[model samples]
Target: MKRMLLMGIALLCISCQGIAQEKKEEKKQFPITKTDAEWKAELTNMQYYVLRRAGTERAFSSELLENKDKGTYVCAACETPLFKSKHKFRSGTGWPSFDREIKGNVAFDVDYNIGYARTEEHCATCGGHLGHVFDDGPKKTTGKRHCINGAALKFVPENE
Candidate 1:
C-alpha cells in the first residue's frame, strides 16, 4: 500500500536524523588539540582520565574541596582561568562547586551519558571536560552551580 510505504520512509528519515547527531558529536573539534600520546605524557593518569576522556573523579576526593586560599582555578590541560576563589562554594556535592565561571572562559554542552541530558561544562581553550552545572545555587548570586572536577583544574594562589 502507498500509505504503508510512506510510513516506512518516514521512519527511516527519523532514524537517519539520530545517526547524524551522533556523527556530529564524534567530529567535534577544539581549538587546542594534541595527540593522545602527547596528552598522556603531559598529564597524570587521573588528569588524563578526567580532562581528556570526559571522566569524573570520585566524590569528596579533591583537596580543593577544603581549600580556603585566595586564587583562581585554571584548566589543568590548557591553563585557562575557570573560576575565581570568591565564586567557590560548598555545595555538599563532594565536588568543587562554583557560583560561576570567568565569562567567556568556559563553554557549555549537553551530555547524555547517563541516559539523561545534563549541562556539561568544559574548558573553552582545550575542550577538556570540566563538569556539570546545576540551577540550585545561592539565590542572591548567579543561581548557577558549576560542579567541577578538581582533577580537571589547577589552582593558582592569588599571591603567586
Candidate 2:
C-alpha cells in the first residue's frame, strides 16, 4: 500500500510538470494567422505603413508612448509578443523604448546601406522590420536602446 501511494504521487508530479511545459510551448506560438491580403484588409493604411513598410511614427504621436498597460507589446504585423510592459521606461526620447526584447521573439540584422553601420531589429516570425537599436540608452539596464519605431508595436493590456 505504501509503495503504491508513493508511485501515484510521483506520477502526479511528473504529469503536472509535463502539462506545465506544454502550456509554455503553446504560449510560444504567435497569435494571429492571416494572409497578406487579409492583414491588409484588417489594418489601416497608416498601420500597414508602419508595420509592413518599416515607416517610423511621427515624433510624440504614437499612442503606445502614452499607454500604461500591464501586458506584453506584440508585433503589429505578426502578433508576436516582443516587449513586456516591465521593460518600458520613460526615456524622454519621444518614443516608447525598451531595454530588451522577449527572448527568441526578434531577430537583428546588420544594416550598413545608409552610410552608417547599425543593427536593424525585425520580427523573427513574420520578418517585419521594426527599427534600429543603439548603444546610447540608459546605463541602468543593458545600455542598449532598442529604439523601435512606435508604429511597429501594439500594446495588449493584461486581462483582469
lDDT of 2 by residue, 33-58 (tens): 45668768977776777666666778
Over 4 Å off, model 2: 1-39
Per-model TM-score, in order, reads 0.86, 0.71
Error of 2 at 37 (Å): 4.1
Clashes of 1: 0
The sequence of per-residue lDDT tens digits that candidate 1 reaches over residues 1-160 is 9999999999998767554355353656778999999999999999999999999999999989989899999999999999999999999999999999999999999888998889999899888999999999888899999999999999999988
Report the Cα RMSD per candidate: 3.0, 15.2
Best by TM-score: 1
Q: Which pairs of residues collide in candidate 1?
A: none
Residue-pair clashes per candidate, as listed?
Answer: 0, 0
Kindly provide the TM-score of model 1 when superposed on the true structure, using C-alpha atoms: 0.86
lDDT of each: 0.92, 0.78
